[model samples]
Target chain A: MSGLILDFEKPIYELERQIDEMRNFAVTENIGALNEEIQRLEKKLARLRENIYADLTRWQRVQIARHPDRPHTLDYIAGMMTDFVELHGDRAFGDDKAMVAGMAKLDGMPVMVIGHQKGSDTKENLMRNFGMAGPEGYRKALRIVKLAEKFEMPVLAFIDTPGAYPGAGAEERGQADAIARVIYEMGRLTVPIIVTVIGEGGSGGALGIGVGDRVLMMENAWYTTITPEACSTILWKDQEKAAARKTDCAEALRLTAADLLELGVIDGIVEEPLGGAHHDFSAANQALKTAISESFAEITSTPIDTLILERIDKFSNMGVYDVVPADPV
Target chain B: MSWFKKPNSGPKKGDGDRRNIPEGLWIKCDKCDAILFKEDLDRGFRVCSKCGFHFKIGHQKYLSILLDEGSFEERETELRTTDPLQFKEKQNYPDHIKNYQKRSGLTEAVITGKGAIDGRLVSVAIHDPSFIAGSMGSVVGEKIARAIRRSIELRCPLIIISTAGGARMQEGILSLMQMAKTAIWLTRLSEAKLPYISLLTNPTMAGVMASYASLGDFTLAEPGAMIGFTGPRVIEQTIRATLPEGFQTAEFFYERGFVDQVIPRPELKETISRILSYFPDQSMSPESAEEGV
Candidate 1:
């Protein structure tokens, strides 16, 4: 009720609330007929929600990716991982809470899981800085990535953030150096890495952990250098007017999961349920698991030296281009 | 022309030097409208304390502030332009060049040199916005390429403080060629594993910001510096709208993830030194190294 609830989530939340109320009524009154009616209503609601979400615009998808009810990095770990032993501070400074990372078991195979997690509630959001990491968070992620390499474990990063924090303290803590170190280290890492953008993959905050052997994005997620609001504000000084032009902003920012896939910015997109992940998180989690498995299978089977070289080549070729004459001779 | 009888005592004896001086020697701060002594203004890194207006810095002053004292050796010093295009519109290319030379006393927009910042050797190239608005042309590209090569050969970092108004139109395709040329050198520098730091100064735009400036291992900018591929004015014109507050400013880019850091001028030296420390110290004296224990 307090934080932003994406447009699509309102109807889903309402339907869920109704279902809960009906189940409580049936338990209290011993009304078996009411239970049957509730089941039929739930099925009808699910179909309606699916139809509405199936034709979402890029902007609508961006909103869903940032839905407050959606899963964060910690939620994913809680659901899918076993034996998650979180590593602590960056050694240079204090620990960063924005990034949750550690060694964990993915179906009994040891791997490192790291990601930006925006807290669901106000107090936790303050602690996490709304998932925007400072220099320390990136350094922590880098530390675990290096450790993952040493232990011959694959690294899986779940990206979700608007961008790195741009506060004075972040700058003082060598934010740029931390990010550069990660980029350099990730490029040379001998172990396999599979990165997925589960939500808003905004700029360097995303890039700080986004580079890997394979980069995947959720079907409804968005990844871009800047958010639509920021882009709109930049192109038009009127913030209020910009807020009203969300569709144009979305088009200009090229933040859709499909756009990123076409631009070669991401390797693949994991499908989400018709309405959204919030409506069917289990299905979304399964899709993510399958995507990670396929990526790991392809990367882990490659020779270590060759894998490292390929990783280097992968980053080196990013944004590389040759401009030919549009009109041929 | 009433000759001085001690300036004819326009004020009382205890009026404390209240003389209405002529306004030619004073310049107003663009941000705060505070009039300051031109000389004192120059000493404050051209930034006004009251409103923090970043006055245009010349190529020499930029070098003096960035490079270690007495460590700069100028490169391409004798290379002067002869107006290869001989182009003219509202102003002739040769005439504009001559006017800039007379006003700024520089042969080209950029000055390339080898210098030490805190005793760590680096090849420093600075673009002077005063020189034809720091437009990138054939000479700017050539200077940057030479500096990159020198840095790679010497195994030192390459630091470029860029303040450009995009590629020069007079050079036409040649100006665009600079983007590819500089990018190639930057890629080579990357391959060599040498650090290439691009310091975006006020108003880095178009071809410059899109190419080598954006390709830094750690891209940094001065506070309030504007760095973008297209100017806000052009973008606004294309979109038929007004741009955002602080659009293209260093802070905006920092938030948008285009910049690594937005440092103030006073802290720049210390920050750069700290970053240099991440690399192995390469400052051992030649004599001491030769007589190894």
Candidate 2:
């Protein structure tokens, strides 16, 4: 957090550093008069934080969402669930570390939890493929979700991926086929599903486990069909402005949590800490836990068939279009 | 209909080879680079006779190539794409859509309707790649959704010829959600036990590939089609290395057990018709295909 201050957050951090210095000086030099100065600076810091956090642009929110200190799927799982039993492998292939799936007790209720897992460091990121799952990862997710359906347990999927891995191996092993199977099966799965975008929900990788009765996103999460950089490159090959227009591309994509909610893409947003989920992990975890619990409480009581029907209806009614008339027969 | 008609005249006596071929009479194959007569190519269903390269034909040509003459009654032709994200680059999203619409002579990327193959009634949705790369947006999603529902209602076999660059960039999340939307409707189609033949053409990628395009009962592909979740350029950028040849091609997918078969263009209609013959309908046969023998 100290090392990775964003450009907009420099002023707030400088104020905070000044207050810390004043407090240290007062304690060392027996200068009690500095308390008033420290308090005044603290107030200014609070106001600055509020102003910056409240008016964060879509691109800034994307930065916060991608902050290295930001909590990952495993963090939320460890903080919120109990009696976790980790499952592994897609049966036909080796286990994929990028996607974590297993049985866990969510507030004493039996549930199957699955999520895309990114890493905290370079070595672990390499191991996790930066949370961009390959074909096996999606296949493993499908297996776990299918198991949940068989066991009549509610499925909680944490989506946090930049996108599926765009590699030769992923393509060779049928990345599209695996993802398509998951979406196809999950659409009609009898068990209840609640998907929450914990970080970055990018394209079909997220949608592989994203179709749920209640699709949610954390406050800072940005979900999109393609990342802004990719979008900018594709839309504006003008080389010079492609880098500059990346922020505009993010805004144009309408990928923020609030934007998605407004667009009716996501069901609701779970609030994060003032700065972001990374600043206060406990508060972020608590908010996510409450959101999941509340969504489960609302959906768990519905009959399975009705739940399945409503889930299908929820996705079926998502696109915006119009029908005027068919061709003359 | 116009393309189906033979050219009123033939090519001139002089052959120009690669340097100066007559523009309208001769066409070059993208794969083989062999000069081909337009009439011969059209007569072969756009499959190059020299090298057997399957050219990406328009959806109208696909309708004529697959469906029986005068048997197609197009449905959901009026569905239109809205600029949900208000996306703009050099041009406004709606204006770009209008440009593609005007150039491709299509209201949207795909055309959904009921058509006949070998006199077998079938529901079909053919994608035209010339229209915005046949990107899937809200309109394409709704039309395909309606097509699936119509198939279930009519209890006819469904055929969706997919040729897309995946989800539309202009529509953003709405375009992405169309994957799940189409997948959900496809699941409903499967539950109805109606056979779905997803015919993959050149350049199917990303969102569309990860949804309805890959969920077909008989997932067929035209020869040498590029079918994958991510395109080669993106994969090359991601991996930061040169790709092995034949990656994500139809033959590559077939080797990997994803594609059931890679049929040539000339035999596509016969292949689909032969497959449809196996499942007439539930009403026609008391024992549905879903029930195990």
The sequence of per-residue lDDT tens digits that candidate 1 reaches over residues B1-293 is 43222222333111111121223456556557677675676565767777776655767777777778887777656545554434442356678777777666677788887778888888878897767778887778777877888777777888998888776655433454455456656655777889978898888865576456777888889888876645566456545777767866888778867688888776778888888878755552444223320
Per-residue lDDT of candidate 1, residues A241-286 (tens digit): 8777756667655577787666555789899887667767788888
Highest-scoring model, TM-score: 2
Off by over 4 Å in 1: A1-5, A8-47, A320-329, B1-157, B162-293
lDDT of 2: 0.85
Which regions of candidate 2 deviate over 4 angstroms? A1-3, A238-240, A325-329, B1-22, B281-293
Interface DockQ of each model: 0.05, 0.59
Cα miss at A239, model 2 (Å)? Answer: 4.2
Per-residue CA lDDT of model 2 for B21-125, tens digit only, reads 234666666667776777776665777787887776778778888998987877776666777777876579889877776665678888888867777778889
Q: What is the TM-score of each candidate against the true structure?
A: 0.60, 0.93
Model 2: colliding residue pairs: none
Error of 1 at A28 (Å): 13
